[model samples]
Each structure stands twice: as structure tokens, then as C-alpha cells.
Target: MQDYDETTAFLGQWGRFQQVVFFVLVASNIPNGSGVFSVVFIADIPRHHCLLPDVNITEDWLHVIIPVEVIDGEEKRSSCSRYRLDVVRNLSAQGFLPGRDVNLTELQQEGCVDGWSYSKDIYQSTIVSEFDLVCSEQWKQTFTSTVFFLGVLVGSLISGQLSDRFGRKPVFFATLVVQTVFAFVQIFSSSWAVFCVLLFVVGLGQISNYVSSFVLGSEILTGHVRVLYSSMGVCLGFAVGYMTLPLLAFYFRDWKSLLLAVSLPGLVYLPLWWVIPESPRWLLTQGRVEEAESIVRKAAKWNKVQAPQVIFKDYSAHVDEKKTPSIERHSVFSLLRTKTLRSLTLILCLVWFTLSTGYYALSLNTSRLHANPYLSCFISAAIEVPAYITSWLALRYIPRRVSTICVLLTGGVSLFFIQLVPQSIPSLSVALEMLGKFGITSGTSLMYAYTAELYPTVIRNTATGACCMVSRVGSCIAPFLLELSTFSKFLPYIILGTMSAVSAAAALFLPESFGRPYPQTIEEMCQGRRLKFPCLPPKQRSKLSSRELFESKL
Candidate 1:
């Protein structure tokens, strides 16, 4: 059968039709960026202490009712506990001063009976402040994010199949509505429970919209433009959205306003349902040949080219000829049937899990670092823009295996140095953390393309889905891992650094997939034959050593 690329060549690569689809579809990813990282601001916990109500006592005396506790070797008032207010009031009436004549620690203490008072220096309000999710309720803050990712995990497993069963355009637009509506409703959440439930629904929509758009763009565009739209275009849009979050959060300090600021932009996508067409490839799979032909003709018209009637006729005839005996749909079990595939699958799983954990651990923990939270988040998001750009350049010039390994190792090395940096030099520590983020982001971006190149087309979606599901397991654990900093400041970094290092080492065992044509079957992959670079001269290829030869091949 002739490839779709051959029949669709008349559509014109990078022409008007492809450009419109590319930019329109890529805009969908920007809101997904907000869904993924917005939790950093929404659930932020500012400095807080116990609230002491007036009991005919002076202001300074009431302030002294909250006992000071040693935190990181510095004295700060306890957040959850305060001295008995009645006793303190009596002492104040007798003109007894706290710590001067009265032994404050020896006095009776209890939980914050009058509730807590949060410092509004950085954040004007957050879920933490609004819902009193501090002290004994602090774990609720982290759990909110975990619940959102749990929804993402569920969505990733089903969205691909749904898009295939239905249509990309419908599923994409449907999920966009779900995301926009839920995000808007969340702004008026009556309680934390309502907010969390809304967040989960929004997460379901977020991942679904992103995946559907990705599939649609890949199926509609032609040649390198298709590849670039998948990687650089959407990836940069996501980064731009992520960077936009901090700026929005900075201006709209209230959690509700911030939520509204991020959500309302999704409404701009409402009109795209009419503008973007369904994937012609997906239509062919469902045997809707006439509809696919109509789209192809439209694309040709937009590109200012003539649609050859013979091309569509021949394509439809070819697809019809193999309708009964086409390749059977492969299951997840098929991936594990062969030894090489099973081993490769396991290695990829580890790489996915470890990379995801380390990536999110750093991402979610940004607010905890000693700096302006908004500035830190902006820096964190801004750094990824260049990282994705560098990843694109590396994929073109460097071997996939080499680039993946180097980037992972760079992240691991940065994590190892993070714990070693002293508290006195917080600026240096922040720089190393940003460096680690850059490395992890680049590796993650490359891994998406590398995994696609490693698998055969028959089981590619199944394999990708399984690996993505496993990766979400890491994200589910990431917030909890970050919560462990309360126990030991170095623990999260140490764990992240260790996992990244091991994954980097394991990457060496995988085969190079740089310039090689993607294997179309399981047997072809097992053969492990590295193809020669089409552009390289035979003399140069022959002069290289075994390792250099592998790199030269792509």
C-alpha cells in the first residue's frame, strides 16, 4: 500500500492549510500548562501562627500568648499551639510580662482555639489560607494536587481510545468545554472538598484535550512541519502558558481571581470546533473514505494546489483492497510476548517513572525554596522554553540514546549538588535547582520523541499509554515525596538524585534510534539493525569506530 504521505503530497508541506491547523491545535496546549502547574500557587502555604482573641489584654500581651518554637534552629511562633489565653489575660491584668517574669514555656498550652492567622506577605490568599489547610490540616494541601493527577492518570488511559472510537475534533472540543467550565466553577468552590472534586474533573479534561490535539495535529500536517508542530510548537506553547501562570498569580493574588485568570482564556478555543477538521487518517481507519476525500480536497484548495482525482481514487481503492486482511490490532500483552520487547518495555517504564518523579518533585517544590514564589515559578517555567528549544536542536544533531543519557545525567548531577549547598548561599542553591529543572525538562521532552521512534507502529499507542500510566504513578507520589521535607530537608533531593542517576545508567542498555527508520513490526525491532544515515558519505561511515559509527548513523 502507498503511504499517506505520498498521496497527500499535493497538500503542500508548511502551506496555508497546515499552518492554520498547526497554530489552532497548538493553542489547546497552553491551558493544559495551567492545569499541570497551577497547583503550586493555588495550594501555597504561607507563614502562619495561632490566632489569639482579645480578652481585655494588651496587643503585645496577646501576641506573646503564642509560644515560640525552634524551627531550623531559629525561633518562630508556633502555628498550631498557644498558651492558655485566660491565664495570659490574668497575668496581663497583674502587669506580669511574658518571658521577663513569667515562664512562658512552663505555662499551659493548647491548640489554636481561636483558629489560625496567616501571613499575607507573599500570597494574599490561597486554598491554604481560605480553608485553614495548615497545622493539622496541612496534608490536605498536598492531597489536593495528588487527587488532580489521579484524574490525569485515569484520563490518559481512556482518552486515546475514545478519540479513536469517536473523532479527534469532537473529543478535543468536548474536553475543552469540560476544562473551561470546571475551572470557572472552581473559582466559586464553597469548600475544599468542592474545589478538589472540581480540580479532578478539570484534570480529566486537561490531559484529554492535550492528547487529542496532539493526535489531530500529527494526522493532519505533512512532513517535517508535522514533526515540528508535535514537538516545538505545542511544547513552546505549554511553556508560554506555564510562564504566564506566575505573572497572572502575581497580579491576581487571590486564589479565586488567579483561577479565573487562567481559566477564561480557554474560551478563546470555542470557535476552533468549526475551524479545525477531523483527522483524515482516523477517518480512513473508520472506513469513511468519502469524508476523508472531502477534507483532502479542502486542504488542497487552501494550499492553492489542485487535488488530483486519481490520487484519492487510488488511495480509497488501496484501503478497500486490504480492509478484510489488514494487520490485527495489537494488545498490551503483545508487547511482553518477546524477550527484547519485554526488556525494552521494562527499561522504558523505569525511565518514565524516575524522570517523572524527579521532574515533578523539583517543579512542585519551587515554592518551598527561599525566594519570591512568583519569581521562582516564573524562572522555573521560563527555563523550560529554552530547554525545549535545545531538545529540538539536539534531536536533529545528536543520537537519541546519547542525548537522553546526557540530559538525565546532568539532572542527576545537579540534584546531588543541591543538598550539598549551604543555607548561607541560597542564591547558589536556587541556581542549581533551576539547572536541575532545565536538564529534567529537556530529557522529558526528548523521551516523548525517543519512545515513539523505539516502538513499531502497530503497538505504539498501546505501549505509549501503558508507559504514560506508569509515569503518573510517579507524579502521584511526587507531592508526598515533597511533603517529606518536613521530616528531613535533604530527603526529597536525595531520593530524586538517586533515581535519576540509576535511570541514566540504565539508559546505556537501550539501542540507538537516531536516524533509523522506525521499525514497523516486533520482529524488525528484535533484529536491532542500526540503519546508516542517508546523508553521510560511505567513506566517512567506514572510518568511524563502533561507538562513533552508532552516533554517525543518526
Candidate 2:
């Protein structure tokens, strides 16, 4: 790394401009807080309506029962008598109930009920019934969810490679344009197939928003400030998305309108092309040291400091010789051989997996709660804002490993309690769910910061991307896992909690990097074995030094 005084001069107020653009870009990606669209499309539930028989209810229990169908021999079977009390009440208000005991003839004459029994001998053989929805088909709904994640998976895997080849600024601009076009097209989609295609393209572009913002933020800030700013940006964006989604859903009941609300804000950032700077670190890596220096000087100038004479330093020699040639050529396989790197990759992957599973699983299951889905989602999301802030405070005072372990352990503990909490006590269940949200959110924010810190500069982006790919494995499994069993409600939490605890234990095996400068090369990272420094007394350093001194004297 280049050796220069800490006090470097800055140029014109480009830093402020960069920060503003960063904030806007980050905020625009907050997945519509109204979450109605996501629930309608991604969660695969649409046109949920059911009829109740012989039940009197109030308005408070609306939306209590969702209709479902079972398959019988060569026919579909359905039932409304299976409706929960809450569902009965909801349908009663909506005119989905029978005033007295009515057979199929009475229901058919009234024109309120549809479908026929397949078996003529109702008592002799099992009769079949099928529930119908007024909205889209189930297969179509599943396709939309699949396409959304596939977009995320592909976009994430491609971002690092694309950003490295083309500059971060270009990638940012291109993806923004692509996302805007696709998002708008989604508004006009006539079928689920068309919508999925549009959403996939939208997903591809959205990844650019995140990767570019993170790269820009890291380049502009220094040391712990880098971690703090990036984590806070993400957390704040999520919190805003969560808080706003409910209101957006309430106002714009139509899914298309909600998509428009989320997509339109992103267009405002396209004009930021003039302001956002290319990554200076990336510039230096590509051997454009002079250009890197110019960018750095501009940043310094903006901070009201004078730019010092810039010197370029090559720290590449310190990297393990074996890993160097392959990495320099951008070989993905090289990351597997380096033990330290491999360990870092595994730990990061586990962290991401746990976070995504816990976060999305809870989000998808909000429909199971008695309270308003919008309100519950909002509260769960609102809890994360404070979690991120608290994580920032803890990172400042505590050692990196300790904070990571604590947060993971906390999430694990909360998840375990979720299994024990009776569903009958809705209030307590919601509270515990919120607590789990807090722990997982805090752990996730910290993981992003910690993963960036652990990787060497040579393959930082690649390593982070690779770990994210593993996390997608968890994301892909999450929906299926959630659907496996009726008793599987707490399964995601259990799996996430256990994985987080395992990651926390693995963190103990990594070096403590607090107060120490970041290691720039693989060699520097691997030079010493990791140990518990926070638990060690300060006098231990003095004792070791004195012992060496006495040995030299002897």
C-alpha cells in the first residue's frame, strides 16, 4: 500500500455529491414497503377467498380463511367447512356464508358456489372438491417467485465480473436504464408469463444498484467509517422500504401501481452520472495510478483539505506466490486453494445463508399472523432500523469477533424460543418474531462489514460475490422448506438460528482485526494465528515483549 501521511488534502466538494448520489441510489432499491406486490406475486398467494356455513361474525375477522383444494382420484377436491373461525367471520361480512343448512342444489341455485362432487356415491367413496380463485393461477404465481430469485442469483454472480471489466460507473448507468425499462414494461404485462420475464430483467438491473452503491461507499470512506456508512445505508434503506410498503399497499391497492411507485424513484438517480466517481481502488488495480490519484485528490479537495503528493505502492509481492499468478489473471478457482481465503469464504457464505433464510422466511410467513399483514411486516421491518444503529455502536466499542458472535448467538436464542411460543398467544409470538428479526438484521449488517474486512484487496469483490452465491443456495431452499410441513412454521427459524451459531463459532477461529489496520495481502492476513485478544489482558503484550528482552540479554 502507498505510504502517505494520514492528513491528505481534498479537492472540490465531490465527496458530498458522491454521498448524496449514494443515498438516493440505495434508497430507491428499497423493495416496495407496501409489500402487497411481493405478497401477491412472490409469495404465490392470490385471490384468497372462502365461504362459511352457519356462522355469525364481526368485521374484525376479515381475511381469516384462505381457500385450498385437494386432489382425489382423477378429480380435484375442495372444502369451505374446513375454514377457521377467523376465516368464517371474514367471509361472513363479505357475503360468503349460508344462512341455513344448504345442500349442493341450494348453493348451485343461489349462484354463489361453484364446482361439483366427482363421486356419485358420496358416502361410499371419497368425494372430491376443488377451490377456485378469481385471480392468477398457482403455477403462474410460482413462476414469478422463481424468476425474481433467478434474476437476483444471476445478477449477483455477474456483478463483480462485469464491474471489473467495465468501470463501476458504466455498470451503474447501464443497469439503472435496464431496470427502469423493464419495471415500466411490467405495468403493461397482460399475463403472468410476461410479468415474470419483466421481473427477471428488473432483478438483473437491481443488483447493479446494490453492488455499485456498496463499491462507491467503500471507496469514499475510511476505516470503520466505511463499514458504518455502508451498513447504515443498507439498514436505513430496508427500514424505509418496510415502513412505506404498508402505506403504499393501502393507497395503491393494485399491484401495478405499487410496482410503479417503487420503480419510478430509481429513475431520478440516472442523472447522477455526472457526480458519482469511479472506484479509485479499482483504478489503481488496473494500473491507472495517475487517474486514481486525481480522483483521490478530488475527494480530498471536497473535504476542504489540500492534496498531498501521491505515491503508488505495490503490495502484491506480499501475497502468497502460488495464489498471485492465478488471481492476477482473474481465475475463480484460485480462491479455493488458499486456506485463509477458503475459510473466509465458508464463514461469509454461512452468514449470508442464515441471514437470508431468517429474514425472508419471517417476511413470507406474516400472513399467518392475526394482525394486519402490512402492519406486521412494517413492525418487523421497523425493528431493524434500531438493530443496525445498535450494531454500529457495538462495533465501535467491542472487538469484531465478539460483536459477531454475540449477535449470532442472540438470533439463535430468539429462534429457539419461537418454537416454544404457542400460536394461541399471538401477541407474544409477534414480539418474539420481532426480537428474532432484530438479532438476524444486526448479525447480517455486521457480516457485510466483517466479510469486507477479512478479504484481501486482490480478490475482495470476487470473494464477497462468491459468498453471496452460496447465500442464494439458502434463498432457493427457503421457500420449499417453509412449505414442507404444517408444523414447519418454526423450521426456518431453527435452521437459521443453528447456522448462525455455527458461523459465530467459526468466527472465533478468525483473527480479531479491531484497531489494527486492514491487511492488504494474503500473506499479511495469514502471518499470525487468530486468538482471543479481547479476553487477554493488556499486560500480556508487555509480558511477552519483556520475556523476549530478557532472553536476548541472556
lDDT of 2 by residue, 161-280 (tens): 677656677876787787777887777866556676888877767665566566656655565556566567665775786677766655654556666776676667677777777876
* Lowest lDDT 10-residue stretch of candidate 2: 120-129
Q: If scored against the real structure, what TM-score would every candidate get?
A: 0.89, 0.75
For candidate 1, list the clashing residue pairs, or say none. none
Q: What is the lDDT of residue 287 in candidate 2?
A: 46
Model number with the top lDDT? 1
Per-residue alpha-carbon lDDT of candidate 1 for residues 1-554, written as tens digits (9 for 90 to 100) = 44567668777788888989998887778888876898999898888888866579876677687888898899988889988878888898899887788987789988987888888888899999999998889889989989888877777666755675677898889989998999999998999999999999988888778777876786677566755765577788888899889888889898989998899999998987778999876665555678988998888888899998765565456456753333344566766765566778898989888888887888888786647898878888888988888888887779988888988888888978988888788889889888888888888778777776676544555566667767778988999998788898878888888888899889988878776554444544444544222212345333433322221111
- Deviation in Å, model 1, residue 173 alpha carbon: 1.9
Clashes of each: 0, 17
